[model samples]
Target: MSASLICELCPKSCRIPEGEAGDCRVRVNVGGKLRATTYGRPSAVHVDPIEKKPLFHFLPGTGTFSIATAGCNLHCKFCQNWELSQRDGTEMEVRYQADPPKVVAGALQTGCRSIAYTYSDPVVFYEYTFDTARLAREKGLKNVLVTAGYITPGPLRRLCKVVDASNTDLKYFDDGAYRRYSDATLKPVLDALVIQKEEGVWLEVTNLVVPTLNDDMEMIRKMCRWMVKHLGPDTPLHFSRFFPMYKLQNLPPTPVETLLRAREEGLAAGLRYVYVGNLHGGAEENTRCPSCGKDAVRRVGFQVLEMGVRDGRCRSCGGKIAGRWGA
Candidate 1:
């Protein structure tokens, strides 16, 4: 009998016996080797606006070639993309046979300013993301990661080399809340965020404020304070309104008041850039200059209506904005 091998990609450290898949469902143990079965076969592929990734500060007013394979390391109870993220390799209805080279070509052909490893956590498709990102970078296309930030340090530090920017979800400050809500712990995610920042990746943070779960003002304050001290105050922080999703359908949608308060908490805690997401048609969607308090970038629901930034600085006051405003 073959011995079980450990998958060291994520904090889960799943032990898989031969012929069986790991906790993510897509990675399988075959012939004593762990294989990413979904690699080179993206189940979901699309050309989406960069703002849709909610990466407001990075490459605004541009499209991104987005791709995701089946399965995610963490099984979040309130996962919005559960269908795409909670399945196995074979369970996907449509798997595009686009290899790493083809994915890079598609980005160029589609006029995408960047390639986004998104929807499902890209950590599960590590090899595919790294390969595609390396090729995309050579072709002058930026690479973005929309992740939950639950990855191991060694692999994450390596992945950051090719990745240009990331919007990592900091789900909860409380470890117990992470376990109950996402079946994951908090420390690894925090570590991953720090690693990404330390690796010089343009990092943005998203906090999905679920009512009665991770919406405590005190906890939000702690997270914001940590971000300011550890990740720097200029880091963009997004407080997103959460709707009842997947296993959390019984829970009511997050009140707009909560999201607003969370944004306030983030900004008050020395964070230079704070925005509210998921709720539409508000000033929070715009990026304001920290010094002049003038509008830097204006948006209306994924559409870039106006840009008050010039040469990566606020045109109104010439204040430096922390974003990769493409030249």
Candidate 2:
């Protein structure tokens, strides 16, 4: 009998050969069994505003119970959450022994409408996320994911069945850029986005604009253009500012001008909803009606300052806005 389980959860498809681990370093083969070492073991947990997920369209103004285990599929040098994402399960330092039922109870006790699998790549903690999502769904609670989207199609299909929405980090548009910096590829991510959208999961994209890495105006335009073509103009795109962190601390934070310019480029590429995040205040932080050009959803630093979307339509011109709006 072989200890390896023929790992195929992500594009890496790391073949663990008896007592070895996958690229994620958490999923390992132990005595002829493939097991997720971090299953039912969490390193981080919080009750966060749904807007903090940066998913404006899915259940706005609501609270979410967020949880994460250790390890990530990608090795992005500029990873903001690298302390958790880069470590193996044993090196996590903090741990919570929780199962699906406990996760559901936590969300209910916290008065959260959804549970988010975030902080580290959810793909590495698939068993935990899947079990929790199943329980959450049975309890009539929603599930959201904040992920790197570096996954294969089979597991992604299984995940989409339970996840109601996701905020996938696009990272960069260049395959060379991804391979060089993030230690991943681009096509599989695009495939995951398309599948999630097709599977009826509300999807949003976030691109962290590192100072000199992925903030090229031409590249930004190209990325936006592809989004408009495949994901539609209505899909919300967030151009988040990056500060020096991890291995890339030598460079200064992304200039405000660069973020604003990228926003403009996205708009020029015919993207209806473009946003700038990680900055305190900006007009691009608000959601405006594409047809009426009126502020549909207003925000002041992740707080919903005002919501002019009446039953998912613009209050000013009665133009239909794309997003989930529930009373």
Candidate 3:
């Protein structure tokens, strides 16, 4: 009989028997070797607006070719893309056999400015994302990571070499709330975010305010304060309004007022750029300059209506706005 082994990719450090997979359901132990089974097999691929990655700062008003395999490290109770994230590679109905080269080619053909390793967590599909991002970088395309930030620093540091930007889901400020709702710990995610920042990866943070769970203004204040202290005031913070889904359907959708409140808290805590997401056609969707208080970039949902910034600086006052905004 083959011996069992542990997968040390994520903070979970799941132990898998010879015939079994890790908690992510993609890393399988075969003959005592851990293999990323879905390395080249992607389950979802699309040419999406960079804004749809909810990346308001990096390369706004551009197309991003997004891809994902079928696995995730964290099992968040209110996953919006649960059907895709909460499944293994074998369970996907639309698995694509596209290799790294094919994925990069698709992005170029689609006229995308960047490639997004999103939908599911990229940590679970590390090899695929890393390979594709490397190739994409050589071809002059940027790489974006939409992740939960629940990864080990070693892997995250390596990934930051090829990746250009990230929209890390912060989830909650309280450690107890993180464990209770997401089956994950808090410190690892926080550490991952700091590593990304230190690696020169353009970082943006998103918080999905679940009603009565993590929507407390005090917790939001703490999260913003932490970001300002560690990630700097220029780091963009997105407050997302959660809709009832997956295992947390018993909870009501987050009120718009609550999202607005969270945004205010983040800004009040000294964050330079704060946005309210998942709600369209609002003033909070615009990127306001911290120095001049001008709307640096205006957007309605995924559509960019105006660009008031040039060369990553505010046009009105020439204040430095943080992002990768050039060709």
Candidate 4:
């Protein structure tokens, strides 16, 4: 029998016996080699506005060709994409057979400026994302990642080479919440975020405010303060409203007021670009100039009404806005 192999991609470091999979369920020990079974076989693919990634600052008003395969490193109880993120390839009924080159071709054919490895944690499909990102970059396209930020340092540093931008789900600031809710730890996610920043990947953060779970005001404030100190004030922070889903269906949806309060806390903590998401019909979705207090990027639910910045600076006050604004 082949020896058991260890999957060192995430903090879990699941050691799988021969012919078995790791904690992520997508990576398998086949012939004693840890291989991604979902590589080149994406379970979901679509064209979405970059804003849907809730990435307001990077390449605003652009369409991203998003793709996701089955499996995720963390098992969040309230996972919005649990159907794709929490399942294995065999259990999934539908999947598309598109290799890295084909994915890049589809993005180019569709006139997308970037390809988002999203809808699931890209970390679970690290090899796939890395290969596709390289191919996409060579094709003059950018790569974005919407992830839970649960990866280890070595793999993350390697992945950052091709990843142009990322929106990492912070989940929670408290270690207990991470452990109890996501079956993960907080420090690795925090470390990954800092590494992404240091490696020059355009970083954005998303905190899904699950009421009664991680919506403590003091904890939120501490998270904001950490961002300012480690990632700087300009790092865009998105407070996404969570609806009861997956394993946590008993909990109520996050209140809009709770989202508002979180946004307020972020801004009060000196973070420049704070946004409220998931719930629609509010001005919190728009980007305002931190200097002049004028609207810099006007939007209505992923549609850009106006671009009030010139060369990445606010046109009203000529203040610098932190994001990738040009092709």
lDDT of each: 0.93, 0.92, 0.92, 0.93
What would the per-residue lDDT of candidate 1 be over residues 1-327, giving only the tens digit for each residue? Answer: 888999999999999999999899988899999999999999999999998888988889999999999999999999999999999979888999999999999999999999999999999999999999999999999999999999899999999999999999999999999998798999999999999999999999999999889999999999999999999998999888888899999999899888888889988999988988888899999998988998888888889899999889899888898888984
- The count of residue-pair clashes in candidate 1 stands at 0
Candidate 2 lDDT by residue in tens digits, 143-255: 99999999999999999999999999999999999999999999999999999999988999999999778988988899999999999998999999898889999989889
Ranking by lDDT: 4, 1, 3, 2
Query: Candidate 1's error at 234, in angstroms?
Result: 0.7
Write one digit per residue (lDDT tens) for candidate 4, span 1-327.
Answer: 689888889999898999999999999998988889999999999999999998898889899999999998889999999999889998899989999999999999999999999998899999999999999999999999999999999999999999999999999999999999999999999999999999999999999999899899999999999999999999999999888899999999898999999999999999999999887768998898988898899888888899998899999889988789875
Q: How many backbone clashes does candidate 2 have?
A: 1
Q: Which of candidates 1 and 3 is the stronger one according to lDDT?
A: 1
Q: Give the TM-score of candidate 2.
A: 0.98
TM-score quality measure for candidate 1: 0.98
lDDT of 1: 0.93
* Tens digits of per-residue lDDT for model 3, 34-150: 888899999999999999888988888889999999999999999999999999999999888999999999999999999999999999999999999999999999999999999
Better of 1 and 2 by TM-score: 1
Question: Alpha-carbon error at 78 in model 3, in Å?
Answer: 0.2
Worst 10 residues of 2 by lDDT: 1-10
